[model samples]
Target: MVKLIHTLADHGDDVNCCAFSSSLLATCSLDKTIRLYSLSDFSELPHSPLKFHTYAVHWCCFSPSGHLLASCSTDGTTVLWNMQNGQTLAVMEQPSGSPVRVCRFSPDSTCLVSGAADGTVVLWNTQSYKLHRCGSVKDGSLVACAFSPSGDLFVTGSSCGDLTVWDDKMRCLHSEKAHDLGITCCDFSSQPVSDGAQDLQFFRLASCGQDCQIKIWIVSFSHILGFELKYKSTLSGHCAPVLACAFSHDGQMLVSGSVDKSIIVYDANTENILHTLTQHTRYVTTCAFAPNTLLLATGSMDKTVNIWQFDTEALCQARGTEDQLEQFTEDWSEEDVSVWLCEQGLKDLVGIFKMNNIDGKELLNLTKESLADDLKIESLGLRSKVLRKIEELRTKVKSLSSGIPDEFICPITRELMKEPVIASDGYSYEKEAMENWIGKKKRTSPMTNLILPSVVLTPNRTLKMAIDRWLETHQK
Candidate 1:
């Protein structure tokens, strides 16, 4: 149901991780920079570059409180940043890994977890800024890890397709082959169940991998009071590897982003294809749900991030407008002015216009209401022209105020106004005095002086006065 609004090109290379706050979106790219952009205007904001990393940044996430951000890079370090000022809060480094693959904050924002290609997952206490523990998984790289919503449990998935669930005591509670290929990403749902049904309800886990499969699992309590795994479903729609998967906060829907350059939305209960979003031009490496479930954010190798909003009501309203336009246009006819007027009236009521085969003569004879609608449409086309003229005038005013030379100024005073005053006799003279001397009271010296050399000013002045008196009588 979500519609794509706009695509923002914020990076020069692959955008690997994207997360959203209430009004802003943060993206980390292989270009080794993190950029924050405004979700409202799609304009880039001042961002802090993570230059400490010598290579690509693989993962970035915002804390639950939206005040801090955590990022992991190929430089084998995980860093915490203050979101408001973009200052580094802490940095945890590992010596063994070539690159850090994933980093995440605990639900309570007390701890940070990071996975590395060296097959080790390290946990750090945010308050102490020290390593809590390091757990190693053999055979393949540790690619994905996440803490449970209650902060009582955590899970990690690796390149060997193994998933391990651990408790707060660092005791491994569940370990198994969750997939046939390397697990790329995993997320826990936010929904909680009653205490008596805790084990049955906690069965919700969504995982995606290089094998082009998304498996949903339910943890069921056994008769012996131990937890057992039950495969609820496998979503297999992506033609290429699935890179990331996340469940909505309510656990009603699931979103998966893939290297196939598409994101898929599925019903959590039936695993039905709800939508296939294919706006990205390259591989969609990451996707995240906005704080509001109505919006989804996607980052891609195309170096763009897109925000989609789900608005069924808005879409329905737009469709209704189109239908109204169609119905009115079909009923319009030239022979019936009343019918034409009715259709035009209906269009006006709906704030739309439908005109076909309109002629200049008919346009000229249109009623005031219809003419106003046409004029409104015409004004829309002239918006750019009006804006350009306003900009030109603003520039001219600025230049004049800054003492720039202009041709439209009076030569003597250098002011932007009309002609100069001239003195004629020993007494202080003005245009009124010169006109009275020539007997043409309204004529200035420039006019009287021109006639004085060729003809008598008295006869010329009398002829002008007779013409002016006759014109004044006719105007009355």
Candidate 2:
């Protein structure tokens, strides 16, 4: 388990938002104050407390550049603060609303989107502090809103279980009833490479709600391509309703915190519960990952900020060759060899191998010799053993490879691979032919351009020789 380095107590009430700068942490609490602390020593800095909000500050977030911090409050106002001097840069107010539940800066930091209890989602231009676009949800309050990473789209989730997707112009492009209960939170993942028409897959939304469920949906242009319910898988061990959830930077892992005073980490793709963090004594209110580290900081009603660092090296080490083999077999058994003589027979054979009574080195040597001579054996002592081992490996490989289709295509380009190559074109080719073509087409011009770009030496051959000598020394 990882340990919290230090605890800095500054908030009198629950801390709702905690954001990290390069070396500082800024936290906003219901006490209507924003505190900045040095990350190195967890000591408070001598900055002015932001005192603009008349009510509790409910949400706060930092701009992508980390130079500005934005906070929203129940007083119906959002304030942007300068990180350098702790000065209030701008204050934008909503005409009518109960409170702003969430606010986010666009990836470009050009605009801000705020969601409020009045069911209104407003987009504000950062420069003018003027509302550029506004849209409404019908039945329930807008609980969460997020801008797509590319700035091409945005999505909002409401307490009525409705999820709405809007284009850059603030037009409703897609809307759907996504859950059984009120949608507590929603986020849009940067589009992923897929075998679909769009190069970017938009609205890979992960949502948690009062239904005690966490769900993932793949939304494209407002259409639902597919969705998976992971209530049991993601919130399995927790008995309370989930209150907060966030996807990791890579979008492969999700961390969810609940009112049950527990935080569960899930494999975003498989929806498998990875670990349950049980340090908070009260409801976990929010969680965020550091910009460039595996360190995760979570805040809760327990009046504490728990920082958890993922045990990446330990996870990798735990997944050794034996674990890999077992995983391979488990996947194979589920998808292949169902039409064989009998399931029981295959199970029995696998069970025997599980016992692993045979000498591994002897089996390997015998198998190699048998393969070399077209299954012929001169030594009777090892012949049967070699044949059995070879048969086992062949059976396993066959079962494993059968479920996978031939003509594996690139998920990005939607083209069959000719040869395996990672390209600057943002697509990976799996086939040799495609790779060869791409390489030949792109490699020629770069080499020719580089020759002229190289620096020239003095007119004499001595200078060239001297330059060559220097290069040789540096190369060593």
Candidate 3:
């Protein structure tokens, strides 16, 4: 039941990408303008329709530290902006007459990497904003790029279905055919080493393609002049090509968006699809979770952005050891199981419900098609187990409606504060806002005209849990 919290409008054309900084939400579009909106008040910043690009902007991203915003456009250039002043800090232009497909910042924020339609990858030093290194791939058209967590290696995917990994020393580590049709997106996920874990399995890469499948790969370093990449698994659910993918901040969940107009959430460790969201009307171009929040933002061809908050709790629990029918045995009578199954209101044409003491009221409401689909596989084996698994999956999804009062919003940002804290003045404010007010503004208490007793702020755990509950129940 994720609800749409807001729909930002201003672009006259297609919205290409949306990115978040510490204080701003930056969006770029085919309108040729990159707009900045305040995360605090949810209002457009003053003088913000950055119009330096002559053509449609293709991608936008904020550096890891949130100090700089970068974008690439069909105009063959990637522009870096100093977000504090809405001014262009530097422009890295390619004269190859092709759209600069994508741009991403290194984990340290010291370097910017971009891939272009001409198959060129350029790295720029953030201090001087000058070209640090230029490299090319043999496949020709580049579509996606990402940096490993250690910032030691970079990966790129091509329209010709090839994936290449490059070392920081300006050398290619591994290049191979990654997808059948071509790669549309790629992301990285890492796992903390535990006892008995394979060292090479610590780093995993997820990539999607026009083949309508997502692949996970195990990445490891080699002692020689290269790295080893091995296929981990293939995920299949989307009917159309998956155009975008992202790993949650903690790397516990992996989400993918497809031209099929749906998004799929997966349990990264088990490769199980936790949910398939089908609320968007057109191609879901991009999807991203808030920095450290459960809130997910998605853009579409329908000229809108949707904020979806998911409850991964139920999915997590289903994976836990607890189960209602865990004690059931094959010898359990059908009459005994019918009592619980009847409550779910599913029946086969064989009148299994009717024979099992199901009332006419429950029997008449049965959805024949859905019942038949699941029951059709019962004859093969494990009829009771199949029924239980189906019921468990259905129980994980829920829908609810609720709203947050204005008192829950932060005073600085009219938008709902995902994290709230209290200052020494005994007033609640968004954590970042309180920090910015005291450190950047060098001001006294925001609530009183006196000097604060302490600059330290305490987490409002009560409010944070309340917000989390609200988001989970009212997810759209």
Candidate 4:
């Protein structure tokens, strides 16, 4: 399951974009500065708030090796920074003195691409910090860009809704009208998917735009065929203009943020919505996934960045994937049980559990009495906690076995809903969770991130009753 781990409110103005390295996070803002934070603790770096840009800092990205960072701005310059000292390595000015909107490092980290408001896209050599090549889009401002994993070709998206593909030599390979109004952002998945043939290099690219839709495309290249861009599918879930999109490093998920103040995560392969997250108070301007972890950073016009994390084991259980279920059930060995206990923050019990040789089957049968007498867990509170955790696992197993309907699960907790209540976002959530969320002064819908029109929560009596009936029938 996905969970919000932190909310950073450090930017002074609208956060334009955010990116993650293997260990650090970089966020640029209209406040005219770029902020660095440690991914380990989300603490601001000592030399953070890098402030050389004379205008709004529009975009930033870390190099593949995590040794350098690139930040572009309306100042008409893209600055390369030494990640170690937080010092500027080079400041390359856009040729036409245009506002730079986006910058990205090539997969190999040897080249960087900066897209400018004047439609100029510049390719800069990382080693020499010199201009490698330059090209421009035909129409409106160039706002978005990304490099293919092979670094053979790069794509640029313009405000005029055009997508142009260029090769390393700066030759325009393909151009097409991609969006109706304008293109907001685009990203290339790092992992290539199988095209059922060994000769073709197939990649997936996700692009979102002002038309409130995200489209996926199949980009294929070969020595003989050169390049081909084929329309794969269109995803329509956002009600307002889509602002940003990114693919997870593994290429299994695609996430997009929108003017609707919502972020939707999609199962890239099936083009299915996996989760809808609403936490940003204003329109989401940018989003990115960490290259080395299941972590996501989202920036918004509200000037805050939200960090989200994926619990892989919990997600597997939530999705009830057959293989994952089998791994978590009776098949789990003593070592597996120890690892799981540690993951559950029950490290103190690891010794006890190992000493008792409690495996997965034994874990499933654990109860308060079993914990207190058999395991000799003396503390009543500790026993209750262990029993509760075991019961949760048991419930998950049983639900998977009984085919629990999705509607019975609470979107927030990913558990069977109790006391479901309809919120302003037209989604139902557990009453206590919704109350806790509102109590924290987060007056936004948990699903859409939109401001609540009213704080009033109507009891979802119908859904509650339906869940009750289902549990009664299934529990027996």
Candidate 5:
């Protein structure tokens, strides 16, 4: 459930974008100004209504640490502002002198990227506040951009319906047509999924466009294979063109706003709708999730920004009931198995299952031979039916373990390491495995494929502690 917490009707014209940091909220508009408010009280900051942009402001984003803010404008420049004082830190002019449409900061806050109407993308050094590198799309205006959580890659979407992926060095890695009409917005989820082989790491990317559809893609990266983007699924919930989409900080939920003047919140994993919001009176142009809260901020063409709070307690209760039934099949007792058998129309087998005390774990281990010999089932069809159900249970259990963190897996062994060590290349690896590789006179870094400067390895106590904590929590 969602509740309207507060509404800020301050902008005189259409609100172009809205962003939230841990403690503050920001909104920019066609009124040619940006506003800041404190999340604690929903009160406007005293030095707010920042007024440097000479034309309409198109987009605004806060740095990862919430210390600085970046806003782009039709004036052909993107300005970096000091969040504490609302003072301009730097003004970067687009090389093509075209109106800047979108801007984003890298996850580490070391780089700032801005996209312009002339199809040009500029990477800026956040420390020096100077241009670092530049690239361009082939056909249309660059409208959307997002950085992957690893900070090694980023993606840009253009009005020509193309999506381009680039590495941190500003080199194009891959390009493809993602939408038929035009791409408006895109985002990368922070959660990483382990590819079934455990050798690859995959992140989900959601892209929405003027084609009135949202597409999810699986973006994987490996040391040897580099990056690969594959189509995953499509979401067709909105009746009109979707304008904006954002993943929650946990990456479990996705919220999107559309020209239909509605917002749809979805369970990111299942692609199921959680709720739909229709409080906005005009086209909803932008939406964002707070860094560390259940609050959401949405901007609309009606010149207002609305803050919505989700009832997470209620949501958790509803999902908990469903999870108990669908997930953790290995924890079911004998009675639970009997009920499931009856539900599957195997009521006649319940007597046999109870006589043998077949619990969930034993049921999942039942093979054709076990069903025929141990259970003493005479019918071949009955054995096949039991085996098929067991196979289905095994498949579901494997999928539940797909969310293991990539950092926990050693790059060389492709498995969780008991002793993590940092090598000269600054990448962690299993200690014994890395020592064997180094002993073989192979003086190269497995991750970067570069020559190692020294043969020393240090214990990665911090990474080891993190892995330990994760295991303790998940194992429970």
Candidate 6:
């Protein structure tokens, strides 16, 4: 089951869209600013709000490289901001005649494209922010746009229910009706190549709309190497019109959110609904799936962003270690940190990261397995006060990493429980917090407030050991 892990509360107005990078998150709002947050713990990052848009910022998009953020606005400008320093790197200005509604990075991150109110899609170069090319949607008002996984085809949906395609050279390729009503959002699924059918090469395109339906299209290359989008199937469960849709990074699952205030997860392979979540109080406007893990984020008109997790041991193990943190820290330069470590006789700690490239925060995030996959550190110990200081830092990183394991977390406090104890019930909880419930407040179990048999809390030695071991192994 997908569970709510965190709720971020910052945006004052409606959050229109959210973009996920490997380690960071960006959310643009009607508050006229784009804010960045740490995906590790949903903590708001410092020096954010790449603010300058005159009106509500409609969408925030991360480049494929994850180092740049582009925020488009109703004011007809797309500002590309540097992810590290929150500085405006470049701005793509469009005619004041139209608001740039949607912008996306090409698969290569070398180019960015956006659809404006004028029914024109403009492509800009990343380096100079110059016009690389532009394509005009010849039919009706362009409501949504996206690039295929291969970057060979560009697709757009219009207010008149028309869908248009363009080749890499910006030539009009095809135009057709994709929905009975206007299309709101669209995404191309990551290819499922693991089945190893060499003859079967196609990606699924999931689009949601005002018609309260989701259409999965089989996008494939034609016999002449041309591209084509074939209608596959329709998914309907939302009682109200669908607003947004997103695919898991691996393209195995698809999730849709709607005005009905419900979110549905679908098995992309079988086209069946996996789970339906009714946690949002208002219309859901934005939804995103983290690229590296089984994490989903949904933002709604309720002024909140809900972070959900689809936890599985296999999914967690499949996530890759991020390689770049050279630009992550605030004060210390990447090379300077490495030099400081070596000069301070802490090269062994540097070796723990395996990769030579990392910053202070990234180094703190290294897991025990990443530090010593072969049990090389098993035989090693602090053996000194310096190493003991590093152990103290383990507590500090508890706030920076993704979060503590669910098992170690206290149910009531929703924080890591250092001193766990079992109550009359089978469930375990933090010693002091549980005591406050039974003794101070004279209440019963929080999970099930049944009459306490006897307010006697016993140490859960087994769980305590596991928590201690986790802390020890993560002591940097």
lDDT of 1: 0.65
**Cα shift from native, residue 458, model 5 (Å):** 38
Q: Estimate each model's TM-score.
A: 0.63, 0.65, 0.67, 0.68, 0.70, 0.64
lDDT of candidate 5 over 1-476, digit per residue (tens): 78999999999999999999999999999999999999999999999999999999999999999999999999999999999899999999998899999999999999999999999999999999999999998999999999998888899999999999999999999889899999999999998753323334578999999998888887766544466675656765688999999999999889899999999887786555677899999999999999889999999999999999989898787556435644667788898788667644476899999999998878877888888888899999877777766654454345445544645667787677789997877677899999999999999998668999998998865556656766776667
Compose the digit string of candidate 4's lDDT tens values, residues 193-311.
54313344668889989999898887777655466675655775688999999999988789999999999987775454667899988999999999888999999999999999999
TM-score sort, best first:
5, 4, 3, 2, 6, 1
**Could you tell me the lDDT of residue 402 within candidate 4?**
49
lDDT of each: 0.65, 0.62, 0.71, 0.85, 0.86, 0.73
Model 6: lDDT of residue 17: 91
In terms of TM-score, which candidate is stronger, 3 or 4? 4
The candidate that achieves the highest lDDT relative to the unseen native structure: 5
Stretches of model 5 off by over 4 angstroms after superposition: 195-200, 321-476
List, residue by residue over 184-240, the lDDT tens digit for candidate 3.
Answer: 889887452111112222367899999998988766553332355656557756889
Instruction: Please write out the lDDT profile of model 6 over residues 1-476, one tens digit for every residue.
Output: 57999888798988899879999888888889888889877788888767899998988889888999988899989899988899899878974448888888889998888888778888888888898887787666676778888787778887777778877777777777777888888888877322212232356788888899898775554324354455655774676789899888888788999999999887665444557788889899989998997889898988788889986753333221111122233334556456435433355755543355655655455455544553245544433423433332443234335345544667667687889987875567899999877667565767557777878888865556656766776557
lDDT of 1 at 381: 33
- TM-score of decoy 4: 0.68
Best-performing candidate as measured by TM-score: 5
RMSD of 5: 11.5
Clashing pairs in 2: 417-431, 418-431, 418-432, 418-433, 418-434, 419-431, 419-432
Q: Write the per-residue lDDT of candidate 1 for residues 321-348, one digit (tens) a residue.
A: 4334323333333433222233222223
Itemize residue pairs with steric clashes in candidate 5: none
Between the candidate structures 5 and 6, which one is better when assessed by TM-score? 5
Task: Give the better candidate number (4 or 5) by lDDT.
Answer: 5
Q: Candidate 2, TM-score vs. the true structure?
A: 0.65
lDDT of 1 at 415: 46
Q: Compared with the true structure, what per-residue lDDT tens digits does model 2 show for residues 1-476?
A: 34465565568888777766566677778888877776666677788466789898877888988888898988888889988888999988876756888888998999998888998888899988899998788879887777776776777889888878777778877666766788877665554523223232324667777777777655434233221111112234356677777877767667778888888876554344556778888888787766666667788887677767777776444334323432354333312222121221223333233333323332333454543464343556545544653444444344334422111333324333333343332123344543444456533212122222222111322212322433444445
